[model samples]
Target chain A: MIKVDNISMRFNLGIEKNFSMKQFVVDLFSPSKRKEKKKKKVNNEFWALKNVSFEVKRGEVMGFVGTNGAGKSTLLKIVAGVMKPTEGKVSVGGNICPMIELGAGFDSELTARENVFLNGAVMGYSRDFLQSKYDEIVDFAELADFMEVPVKNFSSGMIARLAFSIATIVEPEILIVDEILSVGDAAFQKKSEAKMRSMISGGTTVLYVSHSAASIKALCDRVVWIDHGHVKMIGDAKDVCNEYLRSLGLPVEGEGNGA
Target chain B: MIKRVWLNFKKYSFLLKQLVARDFKIKYKRSVLGVLWSVLYPVLMMIVMSIVFSNVFKFTTEGVSYLAYLLSGLVMFNYFSEATNLSMSSVVGNFSLLNKIYIPKYIFPLSKCLVTAINFALTLIPLYVVIIIESFSYPDMKLSLLHLVLPYDYICLFMFTLGVGLILSAVTVFVRDMLYIYGIIVLIWTYLTPIMYDITIISNPILQSLMKLNPLYLYINFARQIILHGWMPTPAYFAACGGSALIVLLIGMAVFKMNQDKFIYYV
Candidate 1:
């Protein structure tokens, strides 16, 4: 289970056209110039998330749907324990497996076999567990022959497949995925979706963020639609997603509202 | 705080081992000479320093061969230099991993320091070989069981380097110029310490004490006493080295804890 209470994130954007630490130091010595620069800077405190409160049950699939720059990724990152919110607190029970960025922890110089263990270790998996699951991970990724090849030589699709394989090797209590399902070919996509469905059936609470509304409707039990860092609507997946699409002036499914 | 750190260390010990393994593998991956470079590097430096200082500068090594004395100092100093230098960029170099995962932030620098320590251990094989050969030639120079204290000296040196490394890695995340600045500092620091020359040349007691304040000098001096002269270091010398390491380590941990959360923003 996870509980997020009034979480907010604030970022200070330096407003100077070419702000650097050197210039900041120079401005520090001259109070008069510092005041002038401060007055000129506008809306420096950008709130990426504002009073975003939500909860996830132990075995629920929650989907976060929003356009780009809507704080979906930021909220996911906060839940994954990679970032801290400026305002409120979050309590997460059980270990979380975050598939935030594919191949983010991989070493380009190491072979795929080595990276399997490397990425596994990063996710806090012990070596013995990874060794036992090594065959399954490789068979799932379908890179059996290329296990000895350096990861830098693999194609982007192959890398994504390897990352997904490593992240989902175990049945995590909570899985946080950010735009990972959109990669790779159609066949691999279908296979990964099946794998996610199996994990969901195995009592995994998944918090997923994606721009695709179709996947949200298909996979999520509850949908939270966020716009401009605020929750616009939260409820049943079908209702919330329909309302979200309606707000965007797009056609609702089965409604015959077309251009 | 200590309990929290201990629990975290226990939880992440596996990750730490893998990271150290990765660093070592990457270091010697494509090199033709491989681990031999660790041995050859200090030997080459010892030869060059011996030739220059012994012939040109006419610096005496008290009674022991200048080469043996220089090698002892070079081994410890090189370990300090390499460990600190590698760890200074450990955090910034792994910004990608930092941004994506939620492991303890100090693990990166700590692992880099450990990998360098492993390299130091490998280099010691040749160092001991050189010591044994020198003892055969110089009757006054004999290997003593007291040299067992050398491992303790290394532990002190490792701790000191790790403490400084933590501070440097954390600071470099915000100020990239720290890399260049640290390079210059290490170069000047090498000369300031008694790596190339004997400290006895400085007759002034106050100046000698000032040089002794250098942590590397203490460890290097203690090591030379045990390895080259076959004499046990005084308990005060042990306390000085260990105490300096503990103080620096505490300061480094405090600084790292304060600055770690802010690292995501800076990097």
Candidate 2:
């Protein structure tokens, strides 16, 4: 179970460029820019999320749908605990296995074999557990022949498959997957979708973010439609998805053919 | 409290091992010299510094050969600098991976320290080699059983460096300028510590006492006392080493914990 209450995320547009200490000190001494920032309302900052409250009960597969920069990724990151909400609190009851970005933890300098253990360790897996599951992860990723090769040399899809295999190795209590079902080639994507279905049906509480209307409708029990960092709509998966499609001027599923 | 900390330690032990191995492996990957560089690095540094200091500075060693004093001081101070520098970058270095998942942030800096500690241990072989070779010139420079307790002082230095590293790594996340500023600070700190010259030459009481306050000095002194003087360090020396290490470590842990939650947002 997860509860995200009144969550808001603020990003400072001004400080992103002035990351160095020298620039920060110069900015401190310069009163004009500082005064101008305060005089103008948002202070060169923008909220990525605003008063977003949601709850996911155990064993529910929730989906997030939105266009680019609609704050879907930020919400998923907050739910996964990779990020903390600016003004609100999130309470999670179970261990979170966040696949926010596939293979984000792997060091390209290390071999595929090394990254498997490294990424697994980051997910709080014991060495013995990874050792026992090592062969399985290698086989599932179909990189058994490439395990000894460094990840830097592997193709992007190979890296993604490897990360997907490591993440799905154990059925986590709570899983947050962000648009990762579309990873790899057609066959591998189908395999991963099947893996996700089994995990979802086997009582794992899942919070998934994906742009594909078909996948969300097929998998998510409920869908949250986010638009411009706010909850635009929230309801049954098919309903919210159709509403989302209509907003985009796209054909709604089963609207003309089956209606 | 200690029991809980020990349990936490036990839980992260495997991760710590992997990170340390990751760093240690990466350092020597595809290198012909491999781990030999760790042994050669200190000796090479000592030779260059020894030549310059002995010839130009013309300092008195008090009793043990100049090489003994210089090698010990070099290894200790170098470990502190190298560990803290690497640790400073560890978090900022892994910010991308960090932003993607949840792992204890402190582990990165701590593992960097452990990696450099391995480097320090390897350097000890050459440190002792220099001492043995120099012993032929100065009989008092001979190795003694007291030297076996060097690990005690080494641990103290490791803790102190780890503490400072944690602070710097956390601070670096906010102020990326620390990456450059620390380089200058390390250089200034190297000259400030009595690594090359005899501490007696300071002459001014205030400056001498000020030098004692530098934690690295205490750790280096503890090692030097055991290795060069060939005697057990006084109880006060032992307490000073342990107390300073624990105190800095506590402060570091406090600062790190306080800032760590905010780190994800900033980075």
TM-score of each: 0.96, 0.93
Which pairs of residues collide in model 1?
none
lDDT of 2 by residue, B10-71 (tens): 76678788888888889988899998899888888988998998988787697688888999
The per-residue C-alpha lDDT of model 1 at residue A244 equals 90
How does model 2 fare in lDDT? 0.88
- Each model's C-alpha lDDT? 0.88, 0.88
Candidate 1 Cα misplacement greater than 4 A, ranges: A15-33, A40-42, A256-259, B1-4
Q: Which portions of model 2 miss their true places by more than 4 Å?
A: A17-34, A256-259, B1-11
**Candidate 2 accuracy as TM-score:** 0.93
Computed on C-alphas against the true complex, the DockQ of each candidate is 0.58, 0.58
Residue B7 lDDT (model 1): 85
